[model samples]
Target: MNEPGDIEVERELVRAMNDSAGNEPVPAYDPQQLAASGRRHRRQVWALAASVAAVAALGAGLAALLSGGGPSHTVPVTAGPAAPRPVGSPPASAPDAARGWATMRTVLLAAERYENPATRGTVQLGQVAALFTDQAAFTRVWGSGGLGATCGAVADGALTMDHSGVLLYRGSVQLPDHAAFTFDDRTGRISGVSCGSGQLPGGLGHQTIAAVFGSQVSGGKAGDGLVGPQVSSLDCSPADRPLTNWYGDIATGGGLAVPPTWQWQVTLNGDQADGPLSAVVDHTGLMTQATCPTSSP
Candidate 1:
């Protein structure tokens, strides 16, 4: 019940934790919290990709007022079935590994026709490029200033070294819908990118994402310990190995987080679909989820 733009992402994360108190290191962050956390995480990744479009437009305006409230009236509701098809596999090749998975499914259908939030652009990258290998290691793996900055395609290919022989060239990027990019296909680099839950931002209208994390999502709480809980389900298959980020070049700037950070980890499945189910992302893209039996059964 937050989504008013997540009350401005909890008052801009409480004014970026009161301007990064004491430590005095994490300061210099004011590009409007880097453009309101990348437009409220792309409107929480299109509200997790049309989660029933605002309750199907309030159930089609209550079935057109129950067909004009006539014909012996009847409006019972129960729905909650259809939600299967979520296994995993595919997208894990390495003969040379510089971009496989059929060019990451045509760069996730051309970055889903360029940020198609249902349609027409802005950002959404839905399938997150099914987890990359091509498209220049998915713009260095999910290009990020923090959120939006993707580019795609660049690895010329032709370098073989796996078995930790290490040459690395895979690809992935699709934050359009909030998160994805799995790099390395031959120096086009970026080893992993996952981001979870179709795209999470249910803090809804969170007062315009808490006026752009002006305080770091209100000094810890919503999933505490770095953000966990809330999210329900999410998956991005393919991962035999390679998804590192030792500080892939470091330089987050306004998008927060310094000292070269950009990590990965995903497996959400939030809405309690069984299993301990837990997902976590950090290094500053900030993602969370947890039921914690120890995280995923």
Candidate 2:
């Protein structure tokens, strides 16, 4: 069963393929095709990752799905998931998120994302000092190497509370990996920053992910790939959830090979116990997944 708007993905893919400069009619991709064509190849790569748990990195590339005779237009859109999608709630009765939480989240994410070698010890650090509760601690170990319990974006998307009443703020990177902060709303400071999982492979699309895992969702309440890795501890799903686009970034060289495309998906890496299983729908109705490293090397 396809998600509500999965047909839209297929329609969009067909439209994109039709508009390509020089190419034949492109058919909406089938997850099974991507799954079957690369069975042995995936085994080899996964075997390598399994042997070296630390080597579980994401592969980045433009999805050039082949058509009948051979691969054609660069169709790279994430697949759509059915109902029972990731709910931004844990087991507890999460309280209504503070209005400022969303605003501060945007600010903190940008500030952390902007941190780099050049910005080290610069005014930018002091500029966002008010965001963190323990400026010294946050600054001491701010850039990369991990921040929250899960190294990858185990708990991303909307905000929620845990059983202990701790705010599960977005604990991850703009890219490269995931993690979270146990924010103290009272003090307007992060009480906990954890990154037990290590950096994950970055910039992979749904085709790559579905090829890698076969899009079976071996274990989940829905088994339809929705309600995937926990999104939050809030207990209910939000009316409007944000979707992560998997467009090939020029900076990362994921688009130079072929024409760039767009994809949007919910977070499927919130349950730290379930490995780095990202779920997204590609243009041809394929779910994407990236195994974020469990621990740093």
Candidate 3:
């Protein structure tokens, strides 16, 4: 009986050793622990590979969206391979007179109103500074007083005048504000423009007014209905002083309410008044020599 049991034990030991050599040792618990470990490692590697592939696909989709599938944003202009078309040029009548004038007017108004009426107080002054030669003239106009006086102008051919008006005041009291537009055949632009009464040195004297305020005005409208009395002839006194500096104790009543409206005498080098005389203007309107008589107060 002892010999039989001992033989059985030897057989059992041989089986265990053979099983370990063929299929690896059984782990702490499961019978198929070794096989399960190999399978789990393979599964983990495959899972990582799949995740990398998914990320690559996502990156490619984003790239396609951003590039629009091409290198440029502008639409490509091309003709079919069978029949190529020719590019045509613009018409000669595309000057767009109305649009051009409207744009110019807008720019002028912006500069006059908000684009730094003077160099000292505003930032936009630099933009409009090129419009005037004398910088000191601009500063003087804004610094002299508050919003006591104002001027405006407008012109249209087939349309009526707009954005052109005035409000005049002298020391707290208001004056008769006058604003008008007329055609100037000579310059092909609107001519007469009246803003308001200003302590501007020359008043509305011929030379001072024409030289100072001419550029802002335009020729006339399409119809001849707006024509006024012919200018006849113009004359200007050499030593004439603007009425603003005069009238200390004139025979008139009230304590100098508004500046006198003098006839604007036109004096130009040669006969440039018939055409365009290069001038200097500020936000306060035309810039004139501010001497004793014409001192632009």
Candidate 4:
């Protein structure tokens, strides 16, 4: 009885053991390789950490934008040019000259009214005197020597304007006489009077004097010689008449001297005459002995 199957199993088991014993031993692990693997693991971990940090930074930027804490960007604006100013108009010298002529007309009208026979008196003369710059001259010419009564009465009058801007008032005041008045363009005051012809006999009246000279007279005893018969001695010469003349010595009631500039000539019947018949008043309304240019005919 040979058990050949059991012998085969025993032979197989012996072969398995012999094969296991014949296999080579396993080698030891390498430290360098393990270190290299650990390093690779650490690199993977660092890569993951860097990715997480990038995501966190992106979140912080988004939060800053949402909170309106970002820097501002501005755009530039442009402007336009300015506008110009307007010009003005010219002066009204022509109208002013016309007004000046009107003023002269008013003065003539006042003088004519004062010379009315019914209105003859010191009270009436005073009203006329107010128009003159020299009150004393007014009194001397009208109130003295009974001149107002002597001058007779004015009947009618006519006013004529000259190209030279002189106002000639021709009237029949108990005689055929013409009184011319020159007005100062700047002051509008009567600057001079060229009176004479028929009205000189009674001497210049208050209205006559005031109509030519403005209402101002030099006050003081020095000017007192201008009154009375002494005024008759004034060098009112017609030809080559010196502009300046001295009348009445200062010792004799104080002398009155005419400056060279206050030149005024009274042409009577084509001949210049002396006396208080004609006068030129300075801008100050004071009577000056200065000779004025002979008035144009």
Candidate 5:
């Protein structure tokens, strides 16, 4: 009872209904597409991890700088060798004798300079003041017309004798013409000075000789002659006794005129004594007898 066209239309309608009622068939799996998706996920994860690591490294570096835990830029230093000591220089701990010798040399050189013609034969009081403890005594001895004038007068002449000697504590430098300079052991001051002819009574005064020798010498009693022991011979005297034999005989109670305190006892050879025995008297006042070393004249 239906037409052919209507039957065809009904068939199309039924096909549509059937398509809507059933679910669509799934597409086939594609290996290439799956691999591409996995690669994209791995790349995203690696990027996130790298970003976290970079942030952590930056934070650590900042913390190290803030806490002062960074490496130092200061350079280290090295030391050099010590300097050497000079020759003939006495050590700090050396005895008074050593110091006295050095000081004596300085004083003598200064005196020489003062006596030079360049200074017009005038004594430099200020320059020589420090060399004496008792300045008054120095003034008395070397003042205007004092012994200093006599010393200046003869300074130009030939140096008949130049001697330096040290005793227990004292020291002396005897120049020509019976002139002598005495220095104290402890103070290093010029204790006394004498420049006179060796004639007696009108010659070297007893007080001057005592000062030159020391307190040990008697100031000269009525018959004691010149006081203390007198030198038996002149400077550079030929030795009458053997070297080994003690020359106690050389010292005598004032019998000879001009008792030579500063004598140079010489052996047959040409060597001279280091210093005169008078230096011993000047330093120690004959408190101790010092044996002179044998040497040529």
Candidate 6:
């Protein structure tokens, strides 16, 4: 509605508005500040990613440990019977040692009865001789009538190793259980044998002897000294002493995998001619095997 005169006033008003805006303050742009802000933002992003990666790795390890997956760092074990060894092996270490020694005692008793020159036809049985490293070793150990004393060890009590390879009876000097032998550290074989107790299976005991020879023998161990037919009992005729008696044939009426049967085998005689007198006895003092006639006129 302004005429040509009003047009000039409108132009002046616009110019005044621009002049007032120019007087107000405005921030100056600094390239360095912008650059630093951009750098900080990128650093924050990287830090977040690194934290996530560490957490993932930690979680994986925990999972593996809990589940027993991935490579394990633990040892594995299996259970079963020990490998079969010939009679009179050195035996196990402590804990199971007492039992092993007891078994050893029984084995040695059988050795003296069966291997003694008077009792056995051969110089010695292969099983008894196998305890030593070699034939020479066996001769060395058995020469000079040393078999009786060596076999007599572990007679009265539990046998234990003194860490120096010496056997201790109930672990006391006053109560010494003579050492039967020592083992080689490098070879795990018998190094030597010595004796002081001078013991022998002596005799099986009155009850055991009674089972073999009724009132014929006065004492139990009297027959231990006799040889050949002299020691023959009610069952055997020309029977010699047992060659070897231990738990004997684990497969016999008991399970092989069972615990030692605790029952020891007591042979009336092992003549090889009589085949162990057609009978055997055990710790219970019972006649486990009785293949004999009741009596004769």
**Candidate No. with top lDDT:** 6
In model 6, which range of ten residues has the least summed lDDT? 242-251
lDDT of 1: 0.35
* Candidate 5 residue lDDT tens string, 11-111: 99999999987867777999999999999999999999999999998798788889988665567868677566433232324464345443443344334
Which regions in candidate 2 have their CA more than 4 angstroms from the true location? 1-104, 111-113, 116-123, 141-177, 198-297
User: Relative to the true structure, how large is the alpha-carbon lDDT of every model?
Assistant: 0.35, 0.36, 0.32, 0.39, 0.40, 0.42
Higher-TM-score candidate among 3 and 6? 6
Candidate 6 C-alpha error for residue 262, in Å:
8.6
Candidate order by TM-score, highest to lowest?
6, 5, 2, 4, 3, 1
> Mind giving the per-residue lDDT tens digits that candidate 2 earns over 1-297?
999699889999988877784566557998998888799789999988786764332111122223234334577988887546223322121332333243244333333234323322322445455555566656543544223322333222222121222122232212333334455544444444543334334343423332222222222122244323443221111234212211111112234444442232222322123222224333333333333333411
Q: What is the TM-score of candidate 6?
A: 0.34
What ranking emerges by lDDT with the best candidate at the front? 6, 5, 4, 2, 1, 3
Worst 10 residues of 4 by lDDT: 245-254
Worst 10 residues of 3 by lDDT: 242-251
The alpha-carbon deviation from the true structure for residue 93 of candidate 5, after best TM-score superposition, in angstroms, is 13
Question: What's model 4's lDDT at 227?
Answer: 32
Q: Is candidate 4 or candidate 5 better by lDDT?
A: 5
**Ranking 4 against 6 by lDDT, winner:** 6
Per-model root-mean-square deviation over C-alphas = 39.1, 36.9, 21.5, 29.4, 23.0, 12.3
TM-score of 4: 0.25
Mark the regions of model 3 whose C-alpha exceeds 4 Å error after superposition: 1-39, 42-46, 55-59, 62-67, 70-141, 146-297
TM-score for every candidate vs. truth?
Answer: 0.16, 0.25, 0.18, 0.25, 0.26, 0.34
List, residue by residue over 1-297, the lDDT tens digit for candidate 3: 469989999999999999889897555766598789989999999999999999997788689878777343567888666643222211113243233233223223332234223322432445433322245533432222211112322211011122233222222232344332222222222223334543322222222233222221222122122112342112221335211100010011112334332221222211122322222222233332221223211
**Lowest lDDT 10-mer window, candidate 2?**
242-251
- Give the CA lDDT, 0 to 100, for residue 168 in model 6: 22
